[model samples]
Target: MSRYPVKSETCHEAVDLADTLLPGNAGVTRAVVLVTDTAQLDLWRALLTGEARTSAVPVVLRRHDRRSLRGWAQRAEVFTTDERLERLHALTGGWPLLVDRAHRLHVELGDPDEVLRRLADMLADRSAVRAFLEATGVYADPALAAGYRSVAAEFGGDQVDTEAVVTAIACEIGDEGEARWVFACLDALQVFDREEAQLRLEPLLQQCMALGV
Candidate 1:
């Protein structure tokens, strides 16, 4: 119901134009919506909370229907009137307009610890664990590697073998260069102090040699 300074066609076209102009991963920091009807209001709400992910953007909606808009204002990071569209454009540029409407409602996603805990929980599945390790490598986090080592040591055996895990950690930490050095040293040694450790490191040595490391 709020009167927009620009024509309705212009405003609608702006949405499409903004999308094409925005860069990949360039999130919307702020957004202004010029609403003309109740349907548009509902559409905006859906966009802000729908299936599409948009936790990184912020939005401001300007409308003549203040009563309805105010009802859900708290759900959004910012809210305003159609008269302020130019100001919103100035502050956010075309990029903010391209933001996922739902994502623009919140400014901060959540706490880092909460995010990490969720990640850990998500990775608990054996398939997810394998996928994560393959994607991120063994030493993605040094603390995580140390924790794995400690846990493997305490458990012992194949269930949580220290040697295999350590080799994986070394592979991750040393990369090709370090893996090659460790592998070479292990191959050269005729007698190993720890048979288990030697057995574990031998495979890594073989892998390095095979890779021509």
Candidate 2:
């Protein structure tokens, strides 16, 4: 199990401290710190590759991709067949949280297709998933917002946020082409949707981006 740092401390700082202590005269060869957030991943990319000069190469960055997701599925023990395994991987696009949710849903529903359907339903109703979509900051763009106005209209002026409304439309629509288009919009907005299904958002970010918060 991964041990989290104190409330006031940052994960990067903890990683740096560990890296510093690992090298000296000890038998330990190297240490790796994994960061999952796209924003934080971008920050680390800039920090590690920035123009600043450093004599020693300290940190190495690696991303979790489709291959990694396959390994993760094996470890999760949720996918019994190759087809289901591939479907799960495709549906999640290697997003860890989505994969975890898919695994949980499979455990509960016991039907692979049903898991996907349930995930689609959860994208609209789950607060945590809604928050994840909001973190992508797609709603801030006027053009994108205008483009999704029809989908937003489906909500009938409900108090629900734009992210949730658009996602609900995507899940509820039957036309594959239109669903694909909606998924593309979500992708452009940086909204989190796994294979055009199962949108996710971080709650803290959702709160941060809330109106008048």
Candidate 3:
């Protein structure tokens, strides 16, 4: 079954592109396209893909695993032992940015544990990562501030409202149909499960989103 409600029948790219360029609602597709600009995303949503688009805004962070982490570690100058490297990869869920940051921290601090500790500490602080998480939470610019506030509120609350946080973030995206792709693509946050329709924020992301809420 499709992740969202839409018919999936592949059509000629030229035909689709031409229809997307023209004014009228001549053609649309359930196929996804990643666009950089929010304005362009809106335009695409209006003209070409409609609800099927997964905007590349806030750029998706691809996850890393042991093999990929080893490759990344090799590229970095840090003195990364296999044990330490594995620990770092597991801790960050192989999110490339975080992995890079952790690598830098390991190089600077000289220990994976130290790097993890500092990262944990950063998440503990209210202001440090809040902005970053909030910025990532947005699917649309108009709802940016509101999305941040919504996520921040959840952070302040006693319990971690996974559903609420995810739902609020989805609300920021104008189109409901495209929310799943957005959520699934959040490899950085590692919170949303596209298949299960679930949201379980990782520690770093939980703290960040909470602060953002």
Candidate 4:
């Protein structure tokens, strides 16, 4: 297997590189392509056409400029900006990759507890959350962020505050479903007592029910 999944611009180049890197395999199913300029469209088109040969594996593309990949939003397996590549690799290449995407979203919660707390407090305050989400462009649609703020404001300072924080963060990050799951778990009051601290999760469940999650 290749040390890194192939990154190529042209179909022929990708195929040749894949064959050279993984001799026995006829082609590579998974790929990463970086499109920095519109001048590379011919190369991208060729790769897209050739990728049909191994459609089973996903071909994710990262665009350096939004204008360069505007037409490919629907075709690319996972569209992201070039600025996120390093973070993406760090998140997806390690043991964490073994977890499903939803689990990964939750796992991130443990990594940034302080940030989550701040976000939760902001969500509880409509004006603050709205300003924060709007300034950050958390959701593609500003209305979605507003909706999340509305949902979050319903239950503030409750035991589910932690879950609410996680939900608000996820919503801001465009992972609404994971946010709902976390909220649901909190509302259920499912406690997981550990040596460090007692974890309560009833607020999440209540929030989920209220949001029709």
Candidate 5:
């Protein structure tokens, strides 16, 4: 697994790069910070199966808890009612980035209702999200892109893609793999639902994509 490009690097090269990346390996710094999808992480571990694992610690950042989200609001001094906070929680699912963004907007607008409404609209705009992902070539492969569109239809309730996209994904690996394919691009497939103590898809993938993706 390399970077976004398909032919950029291989397992061996990445392993060799650990010398300059891991803590205290070079003059540049003691450690390296890498952000990648679950598939890349899996590939890295698989590459190390027969070798000793790196000493560098791995921290997985995920959605925040509802309670902690309140703390974020408190720190930002963005005062709002419980009902409004609940609405924000529903839109963001306690995703840290979204939560922070909401707090910032609340501070600017000084209207909880408007802040929450905008957040909802922002999440639901999949067309914009799709354009960004496509421009980045995040789903470059035709097959993979099709699979992504297929997953988007199911995950975000998006009805934009042609049926052919779904058919292509199903033909490649049937229903199950479509979701796994999505994980290849996203860091986490679901957000932690604090109330339920279970993982749930981030409310409607921004509504555009809870994908945080």
Candidate 6:
């Protein structure tokens, strides 16, 4: 069920609903999939601990990749040129929410460039960046998130050096573990793929940084 908080009362209800939805609880055993969207995820973090721990696991769904984005775009009737499609994929980085919005704009307006430009603006907004960062599970602490946002502002969607990010947060927040958790959460969110020692930020996240949130 959607919009149910992961609080004591709601969780109890979720347990019953879990039994109702998946009687035997086959694969996940006592899990309730509450569908909702928000930038504040402290409630989600709460479910990871205490008595409700086993009953709920906060799992953010993975975004699409280039191949999947292309397929999704085609299905959405975003019939643009291959070059434009590549640009769209680069800008959206296969984030489903972004691709969904971009494609609709693409269909409505004939100019592919205009659509992408507008989409980039949307992603670059402060509120959008804050929401995306929180949703990635990387910024649990407001102070730490703020520090990292400063570093992102410096980079402005350019190639981000992973070590620099870690060191910067460590310096600013003065907590090595919390600093490292940023990358750890990003990994869990599937936002970046590490090739060798290089950690490449996905395009969607890069745009968020460009927003300077």
Output the TM-score of candidate 1. Answer: 0.18
The residue-level lDDT of candidate 6 at 210 comes to 56
Off by over 4 Å in 4: 1-29, 33-132, 157-213
lDDT of 4 by residue, 31-139 (tens): 4443232233333334433433442232332212233332232243232445433333222221111113313443455433333344345346656434432332224
**Best prediction by TM-score:** 6
Which candidate has the highest lDDT of all?
6
Clashes of each: 6, 6, 8, 14, 10, 0
Which ranges in model 6 have alpha carbons more than 4 Å from their true place? Answer: 1-31, 36-40, 46-58, 110-114, 120-141, 150-168, 180-198, 211-213
lDDT value, candidate 2, whole model: 0.49
**TM-score of each candidate?**
0.18, 0.41, 0.47, 0.20, 0.53, 0.60
Q: Ten consecutive residues with minimal summed lDDT in candidate 4?
A: 90-99
Tens-digit per-residue lDDT, 12-88, candidate 1: 45554544556456664644443442223323333344422333232433221234333443355343444333333
Shift of residue 121 alpha carbon in model 4, Å:
18
Sorted on lDDT, best first, the list reads 6, 5, 3, 2, 4, 1
Model 3 reaches what TM-score against the true structure? 0.47
* Candidate 3 Cα deviation (angstroms), residue 25: 34
- Residue-level lDDT of model 5, residues 1-213, one tens digit each, is 335743224543564576444565456555455554434544434332323354444445666667777777777666456887778777777655667778789778988788888887775676645653443333544545455454545544323333433344476556744434433333233321223322223443434433545
User: After superposition, which runs of candidate 5 have C-alpha atoms over 4 Å from their true positions?
Assistant: 1-7, 10-29, 36-53, 124-198, 206-213
lDDT of each: 0.35, 0.49, 0.50, 0.36, 0.52, 0.61
Candidate 2 TM-score over all chains jointly: 0.41
Q: Write the per-residue lDDT of candidate 3 for residues 29-118, one digit (tens) a residue.
A: 454443332333333343333344423233344466567778777787553687777667556656556676787787778876788888
